[model samples]
Target: MTEPDDAVPLRRRTAHALDLMAFSLADVRDGLGPFLSIYLLVTHHWDQASIGFVMALGGIAGVIVQTPVGALVDKTTAKRALVIAGAVGVAVAALAMPLLPGFYTIAFLQAVTGIAGSIFSPALAAITLGIVGPRLFSRRVGRNESFRHAGTAWAAVVAGGLAYYFGPVVVFWLLAVMAALSVVATLRVPGDAIDDDVARGMDKATSGQHRGPSGFGVLLHNRRLMIFAVVVFAFHLANAAMLPLVGQKLALHNKEVGTALMSACIVAAQVVMVPVAYLVGAKTDSWGRKPIFLVGFAVLTVRAFLYPLSDNSYWLVGVQLLDGVGAGIFGALFPLVVQDVTHGTGRFNVSLGAITSAWGVGASLSNFVAGGIVVAAGYSVAFMSLGAIAALGFALYLIAMPETATGTDSGPGVFALPHRRQVQRDAVVGGELVEDLDGKV
Candidate 1:
């Protein structure tokens, strides 16, 4: 079960390359982020409704393409090329934004950016799986997420400073620079180093004689996967709107420092995520996935309730720090869980994509739902409502979701069920029930 060429210099080089790829693509993947809204409203005199519409269009485009893009990643052998193309596409779209600030043109570019940006997650996960294999994937993903969060914090600081001096337009140029670095990092991941079969979740020893991927229906039939997806949807539904709601409250309370406060919230959460992600990666194998994942849900619930308890800026930011704990665990463990459930089925990326699409839907609705609650009642009610949703997600995970970490001889942790060992043993591959000989299911 060891990685091929584990001792070789090429293996070491590809590992380092993956790290750089994750770091550089951190900024490139999200495009201009909040800068898009700022630029359109401040520079172009666009109305709030119009800005929301354009942003929604891009989000919808990304959501619609997520599953299909994942299927493409699962099927394609040219993973490196796909990563390169996606990075270049995002950069091109972002670099064109300043030139074409018209409503329709910006809408189209945003859609382009969204579609291109969707490729990174599945592709990167596939490449990591391909290079390290499942035995080492948890640690590798942890490292990848750590670098990603660090890269985000770095980009935020650089973008904030540059934007302060030159204006919002400077963010676009910064995106292009990151994208170029991403392209170089991607190229450095030697194509030959990636085992295409392993990348898609096929057992490397058996891959030579393996059939193609299972039918898409197999995903729908997976009970654990379906439950996990529901929990993910609920988690995002509650988690996504909290930060934005906090920012609005800050802005209303203190107009002079609203933006600065929002930035502090973001940077604080990201900084905490760096260490949390590393901890999750390092401990997931020994601790098992269920307990660690429950901690994420539990923390989110606490964070939501805490937000309503205090309106003081310092207290709110302190409450926001809990976001790092929740998000860091979720980000690092997401792929590991997906790989665990879909192992030996050869649909890892597509499963990841489908679940991510569910996540996108939840996140998209969160803002709308939270905003309506705020208008109807108040920020306190909205925060409490979100907290309730988070509690539901936590309950779901605690009661039903099984441990996904494999090869653990140790007893289940306090949160894990005694019957956790009875994971589904048969996966449908190309319309046949293939027994999971590795017992990974």
Candidate 2:
């Protein structure tokens, strides 16, 4: 969409900003590996073990670089640049996969892609939090997830169609196109609209101003943040491998429609996720984070148990809708919680990265264990075991996790600062600022 010659209203401008963000998110998501298992299994004739090993490489790369990249996001003003680079790198890496020769080469390439792609999450979180601040973050993030899941849903449908006609390799081209659009959308997000201090998770309006700690240090010592990271890790460990395994299960029974079914599974989950994300955004402020997040874990647990009860593609997919419930809430609330916990520390991005690194560890391990278990005992046992793990995670969250809304005791102390109540913003007309208040433009 082109800009108007006349000054744009604030509402329209806000919508534009969100649309750009949605496009950017959609692009980055393209490179993430939902289809990799299908590609390895159908294209390369790889076994479950090999597919799991290869997929785990990306998770390993994230674990290695997530914290450092997050700290860099906190320190750098090039948040948008990080997102662009990650998007482009992922697209290029994905497109090059078919041309790559060996398993080791592909794994290494995936790892490289992981390194490049790790930049997007923390940077995007930083950008959004900076633009909206803590007060509006929950709702904005919900909208972000809605757009993001919508992108994922759209990508799955398009990729499924392309793969149905031209083979899975065609999916790569679709990603490349999406990546290009993502770059444009990213560029559309106004650079000047971002408040750097606020984005870094600090507000100068607060009294007793002081640099407390680096993001790494603060996140390390924060008990709730660390525990939350552990909870996320456990959740991802169980959640990540279930979809791929479902694809494998379908392939075993119905090789002809396997790819199509896998895509359908993704679309179904993402479609549900879009609405669930909006629901979380609308309710998190009023209802609080722990209950919402715990619901996600509980759904995952139930979904895991349900997977083994049916070999029917429709039944398997219906079970995956349960995933939408868990994933949607977690997606919107994860960074929001992080922002709340680290609100005033200027380590919001880095802290998010730290926790994501933990998530990476579990996600990577999920593939490995799921593969081994499927080979050893069978799919039913594998599903049940994963379900049990998810149940444990839910138990942990229910017992230990505290409510983390702004006024809650477990939330960050920054909101309690006196200056927070007095902060105000200046209005802008067109690209020109109408006023500036204490460096807020």
- The top-ranked prediction according to TM-score is 2
**Weakest ten-residue segment in model 2 by summed lDDT:** 410-419
lDDT of 1 by residue, 1-441 (tens): 232342334445666788899899988876775566556655676654565567656666777888888888989989989889989999999899999899999999988988888899999998887765676577778989999988877777777677667776777898999999999999987776566676888774566565544434545778888888899999988987788778667755865445456667777888999999999987888889999999999999999999988899999888888999999999999999998988777888888888877776777667567767877788899999999999999999999998877762221111101221222222111112223423232
Residues 1-441, candidate 2, lDDT per residue (tens digit)? 233343235324644665566745664643547577887788888888888888888888977999889889988888888888888887888788888837998898789777877887888777776665566566668878888898888888888887888877776677777777878777866665466677778755652475666645766689889888889899999898998899888867877667778889888999999999988987888888988888899899999999988899889988888878988888988998888788777777788888998888898899989999998999999999999999999999989878878743221112111222312332221223223322233
lDDT agreement with native, every candidate: 0.77, 0.76
Alpha-carbon RMSD to native, per candidate: 8.5, 5.6
Clashing pairs in 1: none
Residue 262 lDDT in model 2? 82
Which pairs, if any, clash in model 2? 130-199
Q: Candidate 1, 11: how far from true, in Å?
A: 2.5
Off by over 4 Å in 2: 1-11, 30-32, 206-209, 408-441
